[model samples]
Target: MIASVTNAATLESAFNAFNEQSALLESSYRELQQQVASLTARLDEAQSARHRELLAKERLSEQLANTLEALPGAVVVLDCHGVISECNAEAARLLNQPLLDRPWSEVAKREFAPVDNADGELQLHDGRVLSLQRRRLGRDLGEILLLTDVSETRRMTEMLARQQRLSAIGEMTARLAHQIRTPLASALLYASQMSPGDCSDASPGGKVVARLRELDRMVADMLQFASGSNQDDEGIDVALLLADVAETGSLPMEAASRVAVNIADSNLRIAGNRGALKGALLNLLDNALIASGDEGRVDLGAWRDADRICLTVSDNGCGIPENELGRVFEPFFTTRPQGTGLGLAVVRSVVDAHQGEVVLESGSQGTTVSLCLPAAAIPSAQRAPERGFCHA
Candidate 1:
């Protein structure tokens, strides 16, 4: 009976140990499940952030595409391999392509040349001229090409060349006139002294002499307008410049007696060749007076703006045609019966030398010439003469 009791106690102890180990295992499995849930939540949050970043990148790319497409000038974007990635509408028009994704040589075969320099002006095979500007897109990306059509600019250049030629011819004509005037005048005086008895029955010398006299006067005026010799580099008061031009070039008091000259006491100053400025102002005043004719009004004035001076000569005369307005500043261009056509041209040249600009506004009512010049320094310095002005 004692042996049987001992065996039963030993079995009971083994059963209790087994039950405790099973409970401990169950608790460990629950803790492991909780740790797995926490890790899964963190992974899910990271994925959401990654997705948002990808979406933002896509939006930015779309915006960039839209902006490139809307630009006015031709724009071409290239990849690192020098392959074209995208092009704008203007690029398509310039290259004559509906779309461009191939290599630049394939798309702009006729237009592409070895990019010799960073940027330059080039003429296409199709007779189109463009100013090409290039910039690196990023640290390692390819470059961007910006092409600006300069065909109109070339046309204007040709027009300016023609005008310059005409002006040179006018000046030559004036010099020739001056050279012949003295002799021609003497011949006319001698012919006038001769009587009918000394000449033949036809009296041809008298008629010839009369024509020569008229030619001499025309030549003198031509030389005066063409010489453009009065432009000497000197400091000039804006108000005094206009006043002197009026006193010198204005029509006789008897002819345009009603014309008025008004000057403002703005004390504006210009650092320029005095002769050039004076001549330009005089031409402007003359144009105003001639346009107004007798009984018309001409107003001359000047004022100061921040770091600049504005001089204006206005007239109540016949205005210019719209089409001709663009050509007025061109050399040897005129609408007058006896005009040498260099008045405004000389004016523009002079103003340009002073680093200034001349704006012309003409209409049916009248015309106004505005000259904007950079103000001279408060304490002036002596400087060398400037080259003649060239306006584009």
Candidate 2:
């Protein structure tokens, strides 16, 4: 009996130890199941966030597309490979095609060169001119294109250049007048003293004398137009100039008198060759009056801002068309049947001599001419004298 109890006690101890180990294993399995569930929950949350992010990205992409499409200037989105991914309305109009997925090469082939910016001017196949610009987003985002029509700008630039050229010619003519005037005048005076009968009917001397007389008259007229030395360089009140122009042109007296003169301030003064300025202003005024015909209005005005003074002459005349505006200032270029075409040319020369600039703005309603001049420097030792008066 004693041996049997010992064996049973040993077996009971073994069974208890086995039971503890099994319970420990069950506890470990439960803990593992909880950890697995937590891991699964975290994975689902990440997936959900990712899906939300994708949807938000899609919405943002749509918004960006709509924004780009609505831009006024030409908008083009290029890929990293320089291929066009999308284009806006303006771009389509400029390229003359709806380039949804077309490559940049295809559009470029149609005469639009890739420019660094849209500020540069371009000529199209259909004779249309445009200015192009590009904005690079980043190395990965490619570029955006903006196109603006610059036909008007180009026209104005051409006109300015022509005016400059004419001004140069006028200067040359002035110099020529001085050089040739004395000799021609002497020749004509001597020729005139001798009657036509003094020389043989077909004498070369007689013919030469007649020609010299003609040349003398031409030189005098040229001298009158070309030499600004005769003009007094002094500070003059702008109001006087405008008033003189209005009165002299009879713009205020005409039955249809639609012209008005304005001066920003009575104290506004400019240091310039008065005669030359007057002549220039008068020429411009005459053109404006003529352009207005018998019924339109002309406006003469002056204003000062900072260190610059601007004189403006505007007229409700037949406006210059876009294409013809460029050639208007060109020497001998005239749109009218009897236009000398030298009026604006001479005006530009005078302005340039005064170290000033002339700008033209024309549209359907009328044309405006603006003359911008730099303020005169005050003498370090002398206070500027008061503005003087002129006949205008």
- Which model scores highest in TM-score? 1
lDDT of 2 at 142: 84
Q: Which stretches of candidate 2 lie over 4 Å from their true place?
A: 1-232, 251-256, 376-392
How do all models score by TM-score?
0.45, 0.43
Measured with C-alpha atoms, the lDDT of residue 79 in candidate 2 is 85
Would you list the C-alpha lDDT of every candidate in the order shown? 0.71, 0.73
lDDT of 2 at 342: 62
lDDT tens digits, residue span 1-392, model 2: 99999999999999999999999999999999999999999999999999999999999999988887777667778987788887777787778775767777777776665444454576777666776688898978888777777777787998799668757867888667666777777777777557655554245666676467445434433444455425356876677777776676552345125667766455666888876777678777777877877788788888877887888999988788899887776556778775556667667767887788899999989999988877655554545344433332
Regions more than 4 Å wrong, model 1: 1-232, 378-392
Q: So what's the TM-score on candidate 2?
A: 0.43
Best by lDDT: 2
